[model samples]
Target: MRDVAKVFDRTGSTLGVMDDLQVALHTYDGCSRGCAGCVVDKHFKNNWRFRNIMTGPDMRIVGERVKEYFHWIQENLNTKSDGYFGTNGYKVDHYSYTFRFGNHSELPQDMLEEIAESCPSDFRVFSTAPSDEIHKFVDLRRTHPGNYFLEIIYDPVADRAQDIRDMVLDMRSNGILGYPEVLITQRLLQAYSPERFVEEALGPLGDIGTQLQLGRYTPSKTRGFRTTQVVSVDEEVRWMTAVAKGIVDRKYDIHPIPIGEYAVTFLDEYKEAGYEGPDGYIDVARLPEPEPFNIANVVKKTRDIFLSSIYVDHNLDLHVWSESMGQHVLDRNFGFEPLGNVRNRPIHEIVTEPNGVLERMLREVVRNLATHPKCSGCRYKSFCASHAIPLFRKWQEDDGEHCYGYLPVIREFQKDRPFLTNMIDGFKELGF
Candidate 1:
């Protein structure tokens, strides 16, 4: 059995801890789209000047490296006698990996096929811009079909709606096995109200079994340069809740990513509180405002935010996470530097070496969570630790302020708890 860590709140009540690891592979670093508010654009642009571009053969080599790394992890780390404890002193029991062929650039067909051939078992995600080449993905799916998903980055400001609809329709017509994931950034949410977005965008795509991911735009020095276009926490909450309600309504075959994850959290809190109305129904008014800084909640939120994920960028540089890939670009001494480039050394050597950079940084992040005044007192400290730690380290400011955003959505769901609960139950009954 895997050793489990006990997470406690300020009052010493027990909280749940996570025990899984995820690896994100970035195969390329140059994108031609030049979409608005691209999180990796600046980093990619900077690296393009100095970094060697990865060719198809280079990607295959990376694929082999990743496979060897995973085998080493399973043989050495994921054992009863030698469990892996990487994040905040939490032990991880299982490991899963995601391969994103083009984290920064649009994936070419040859590179996409190389990834497909290299990692046949792993869940492979190809990020590409809106182009006629997207149709080639259908053939890839037909030839090699496992946990493969194509993520189409749709910049509502720059891309046309018809293009998306046409591409999805083409995939369906060609007998593509699974739906392609579409990414809509915060700018689109700001441009169109949640209701309007659902009616105009999500509605058509959802009917076709396309999964939509709402990308939250955070103000980073490199990405989201157009600060004026960023949406507020309130607006984000509105969009998320509306989309979740749509899922509960069975309006589409689409599955909400983080929204569903958030729903599970809110559901747990609702059940634990046991608040009910006169008719034994959930009373939204009776629900208490969540204590974001409560130690147990903070730990759980940090676990959720982190998802025990690590990133390997195009240069074969291992980052703490995908978001941290650009930390050096933001500030050279951001502290969360790449663990070590895989090109120079094997991943196992870099990760398993005693007191290595990765371990030291993990300890440092946990220490900061406990000692940093802003983090110790702030409501969204967990988020700051897990998602925005690099930004926080650079600015010495709280980036987790948006932690409160989940409350409004929870409250809204509570208003229709019975129906929503029944819908979730029905989903289970149908084996979803």
Candidate 2:
């Protein structure tokens, strides 16, 4: 029922780059899962006075906004002209969309069906539904066949871990995409007792056969009444490495997971600064390439801003990352003026307008990456150069709630390092 399609570029330009534009339409807002370490809860809600729990009827508006954007893509981006790939080129790839951004939100069944019917076969369907409704998504994929690829997140700490285990076991036994992606965070790791973690968490997948993947949880702040737990730098590396080692030593059927190499490569700047933890142990094993730590090797030519993908929030407001803070650049309200509206403007103009917010941001980002002193001398320039300025800008704007730490580039280096390392290795190019 599920399928995989190769994606080369989102802009459909003649350049043979491989960046994918993953547009996500948020079906709902406000998560009920209430994971202890969620950034939304820790930073957005507590500090910014950001309201959570926007759902139900609002999803219809999300669906409509996505439909409008999809319509625009079909009219403008998905063209029949072969010039997009040039005369000698054989394949052209369009930007793909997914209904995957928000957590603890449900989709209107009718809207899901409409999206399943409308998007290209390569469109991915990502969900984090509880175990009982997990099958509903699989069934949806079965009905749609090759139209979409299915990605489900099994949050081990989510109260339904047992149900998740049961469903994953069933899928693996029945050969249904094996086991879906399991997301284990420090929040989850610290939640369960060690004995329960081994018995309930790791025990179920003991026989899935080298098909599993160990994912590194992103660096984040866990909010507490009197203090905040900033899981950055050393902590992020340690936990991810521990998770990877745990998976490997258990003799599960997962791929190598690359946690070691990623940690090693991404921490180049830190190591250069002679930074070392109390134990002086580097969790991940290092890789040899990127010898001088070149940025060119990580990112390709086409400039990309952070959170470059398009997202339509629950309120039908189109959003993009206006700054490095990952704050929503809404097409409508929320006190901030948006770049452009999906409801009124064409897709190309919104993204490519010479003086648009995204364009200006991208320009400054590129300029800063080229000129910044630390970036000019740093080894991982390619990986962080594109958005380093905005990340710093966002940190200043938001007071470092979601951004992590006060040190200029230290937190930025640690925040998404593990994931970026895996992505860079996976794509053999820089990714954000």
Candidate 3:
């Protein structure tokens, strides 16, 4: 029952930081967290097999498909018709996605009490599990307080430092709320020492409120045949600018998170079942060499080009996300299938289907980027001609290679978020 709490809207320059509609609910079907940079074992290696476990008739078919898709999104997309977010005046409202909505694994306490009692929004429960499977979900913070959080990952080349100091002292002794994602590889930026990893793994969680984040370690691929580990957006922007300079010489007051651009597929049923991946010709010779396109990475690459996200999977299929063209997450299917079936139509007429197909592939990606030519000399070409130039021409027609690896970490994340480059140059003067 994925995208159960389904909602929409996520177009250009994140329409001023996503103004409404965004639910995202998921129960779990696989993912036992065999994390070796798990992008679902780099796209289900050897045809899937790293699951967690859930039984009881898989929690009664995930509580009858999440209460029948949240009763068909409160009886069909909660009102206001003829989309364009209701005649372009926008104000939709749906919220609820405060942290994990599945996929980083570890929730099974009866699937977190059937997503905190048959979902209805208000989420937050990401984990990595340790302190004894997170002290059996600490009675979900006395049954869900400030929505329950954990987020901990800190894999300095495969986690340890005493299992991240006993899961941050069993999440500050169960009071919970203890964020810290930190991944940055290349063997943690050439064997990161950062003063014994900030003096014995982030100085014994001093803050008690941890917020670090800092991510990166993408590179996945696996379907039919198998094996694909290409790399080159100039060596993942020099290993994400040497792990954002080891989280700034251990100054450690982090919050980077931007790692976008990764499309290199090459299928043909993994080449008529011969299979032998790797080597993606320098991601097709650095796709027209662009990067360094300022205006602060247009809302993290326009949230992977105009595809705001929706995601409901476990056979209730509805998807809508659209980024990650490669390293396969089913290439973020926005439409080529399942624009319906929330257990039989009516998710607002399968998202306003006026000859739909994701509205003619988002209006032919603005008439193929207003008639391309390497999108008129890049410079964030009109926000990638209204959203990632038709996802880089379908990642060069699925021969794949579009990983711009966030252009060498957007000049060190516009030097500590310089007001997010004036709100991405004020949405490129309203032409987003």
Give the per-residue lDDT digits (tens) of candidate 3, residues 182-296. Answer: 6544555456554455555555543332344554344433222222322334555555555544544444443333331111111110111122224311233333344443333
lDDT, residue 277, candidate 2: 34
Best of the candidates, TM-score = 1
By lDDT, the better pick of 1 and 3 is: 1
lDDT of 2 by residue, 353-424 (tens): 767766555555556556655455444545454323333433223222222222222222233334333333
Residue 57, model 1: lDDT of 61
How many backbone clashes does every candidate have?
1, 7, 3
The worst-scoring run of ten residues by lDDT in candidate 2 lies at 1-10
